[model samples]
Target: MSEKPEPVDYTYTPIGTIHSPFKDIVGMPIQPTGARGIRGTIEIRSDLKGGLADLERFSRIILLYSLHRCTGYSLKVSPFLDPTPHGIFATRSPKRPNAIGFSIVRLVGIDDCTLTIEDVDILDGTPLLDIKPYVPAFDSYPDERSGWLGAVAHNAQHAKSDDRFQ
Candidate 1:
């Protein structure tokens, strides 16, 4: 028999929660492109209010969240954008050990501790971990390597997430 790895513990509390129209997993967009113009709001914790100051300076922000609904881990997965299985690191499959999610969304408005955003692909009530301004100059690229995703990025809008992680 193979030896088992030891476990380590760490703790994190959600700074906020995302509220979106997507209640069910079926038929929901697997990524932001498919969820074009879909609206959502992030309700940030009052204690973290100070951190959000000046966030309105940018029209877009990157949301880092937790896929609380997903559990477990897999080193290989058939991602929504492809048929053949690939390493988990090659795709944003939520069945990661950390269950983290990321999205670059258009900022609509900010009201107190809540932020209205668009192009949402995450599920409702997802835990918000952090947010950062999206600067195209730093985040955009003219040409870059996509590896396996290069072939399917064009069809990603039509891709729907299935239970490959579960």
Candidate 2:
């Protein structure tokens, strides 16, 4: 048998901070669909202001941020839409091995280092890790299956987060 490779650690610096209306995890929308029209702002670091160039061209942007408040992780979790415990990788549980989460929000406008965004489901004061322009042709999959989520995915539009993940 082949030997397993050694694990390596990496470091990341926050490029900015995400500000949202939801301060607490309780009662906050679980997904962007539920947080539709909710406005928020991203305060990019002054040093990274130059990176914002031509980013506003996209109508939507994918935000990868750190789940700062999530303490620990579980291999299985009962997500907001369903109470059945599923593999953490199968669900978008904030409690992950890396405590990282991502959201695709509508880009409203950008001024210097600040970006006005809508359909935000993230918590306030979340550390912004990275941002990528959303391209439908590349991100959308018309024939893709969502496995277990297909049954309860519709409820996401109304589902709200509880203290379970915390």
Candidate 3:
């Protein structure tokens, strides 16, 4: 058997920044559901503006961003919706080996290199890593298990984020 390679550091220059009214982690929405109707703007680098071509064709988009403000990590975290702690990978906790965040947001409009979006749970000035059109036909799955989340989902609707992971 071949030997596994050693881990190496990786660096990514932000392609853009997500701007929102949320200036702090306190009182912010824990997930997209709680952030519904909240608007934000994406300022993409001028050189990458062309990548937005035909993006308007989709009503919703997926945002991949860096949790720039999350400082540390934990193998088990008490997710916003539940009091019991779960494996870090099993949760949407921003504190992880790589502080990357994902969100499915409504695309309101686009103007040049900027995009207007709604239902944003990301923090203001978060670094945007990538964006992809959310195709419901390919992404939907009615029969999926949510594990412990299933029983606690009702709490998610009203749960606001705090500095628990930050």
Best by TM-score: 2
Q: Count the backbone clashes (under 3 Å) in each candidate.
A: 0, 0, 0
Decreasing lDDT order of the candidates: 2, 3, 1
lDDT of 2 by residue, 12-56 (tens): 999999999999999999999999999999999999899999998
Candidate 2 ranges with C-alpha deviation above 4 Å: none
lDDT of each: 0.87, 0.95, 0.91
Q: Tens digit of lDDT per residue, candidate 3, span 57-156?
A: 9999999999999988999998888788899999998999899999999999999999999999888999999999999889877689988887877776
Q: What are the per-model C-alpha RMSD values against the true structure?
A: 3.2, 0.8, 1.0
Best candidate, lDDT: 2
TM-score of each: 0.91, 0.98, 0.96
Give model 1's TM-score versus the native structure. Answer: 0.91
User: Model 1 off-target regions past 4 Å?
Assistant: 1-8
Structural RMSD, model 3: 1.0
lDDT score for residue 26 of model 2: 98
Distance from true location, Cα of 129 in model 3, Å: 0.5
Off by over 4 Å in 3: none
lDDT (C-alpha) at residue 30 in model 1: 89
